[model samples]
Target: MSDRSQLDESGSSAGEAPAVPEWLRRARWVWLGAMLLGLLASVVQLADRETLVAEIRERSPELSQQEVDAATNSGILFTLLVSALTLMVVLLLTNRMLQGVNWARLVLTAWAGFEVFAMFITAIGLAVLGRGTIEQLAGQSVSAVELLAQVLVTALEIAAIVLMFRPEVNEYFRRMRPRLRRR
Candidate 1:
């Protein structure tokens, strides 16, 4: 077929010039996946903390009813709020960044890296600190499922970071970056 035949009605070639690099496309998915992963981690954290509070109550029956209820309800409420906020921010950032928003990319990168660090520490605590408390846990040692979830979440965050820093991916942001005002 002739080139003219491939042209759009406006006469521009159908093979348009705004070609997105494969790496950037992959990065978008990676970033989106990271946001989902972070949200998932937040959910799991909320649930685990709730379970911990329940276990605490079971282990300490003598604790005043008011005390147990107060702590348990407050902990869950705070965690839910935080988790919901985290989920919203992550999804928002991911969506904006993929759309070539420079500020959004920066925010997501910073947040994801910091979150990974936080998850790493939490994972270590679950894997090690729980071991110390195993006796108190009375055979309810932290299980493989919990450990794996932590590891998976950590790995997902790392993947997101790696994708963000990919040469083509970073270049996309560089191209979209706004000029800074001179001092």
Candidate 2:
């Protein structure tokens, strides 16, 4: 076919940008929701420091009150910094993904996979060590809000991943692929 004849209705030739599909837009919002939920969970977890101290004490009866207090303080600061950094990374990647960067989409998929894998490993370890059930974990180290947020985050991530790979989204990405190569 002639190059001009091959142009899409958008009046742009091949390798030119096309309008983003609706499914990709929905996927971006869904991914944003997951990131927000994760941020909320991290904040809630840090707020309940007494429970953190108690959990630490239960695991190590030998640690003095002073040591536990020190550890809790440091741990809270570390967790907060990590959470903020993670949030920044998520925002950057999501922006790139929406711009039709295929690598960004793959990175997000890998992230979700790693999160699910880590959760599975933690659950198995807890069960094998007879640590306690989800209810018990909530009562001890984790707050109800945090646990709920985590579950919702995981669900949303999975939903967003599915949406990202829809037929229309795939076509959009395919159209964008040539543009990427030229750059």
Give lDDT: candidate 1, residue 7. Answer: 68
Q: For residues 1-183, could you state the per-residue lDDT of candidate 2 as single tens digits?
A: 977558885567764588888988888888888887887788778788878898888878799999999989998889888878887888888888888899999999999888777667656756675555654654565445665787688788889899999988898888888778888
Clashes of each: 0, 0
Candidate 2, residue 126: lDDT: 62
TM-score of each: 0.60, 0.78
Which regions of candidate 1 deviate over 4 angstroms?
1-55, 58-62, 118-130, 133-143, 178-183
lDDT of 2 at 85: 86
Q: Residue 84 deviation, candidate 1, in Å?
A: 1.3
Which stretches in model 2 have alpha-carbon errors above 4 Å?
1-6, 9-16, 60-66, 119-145
Best by TM-score: 2
- Candidates in order have lDDT scores of 0.63, 0.81
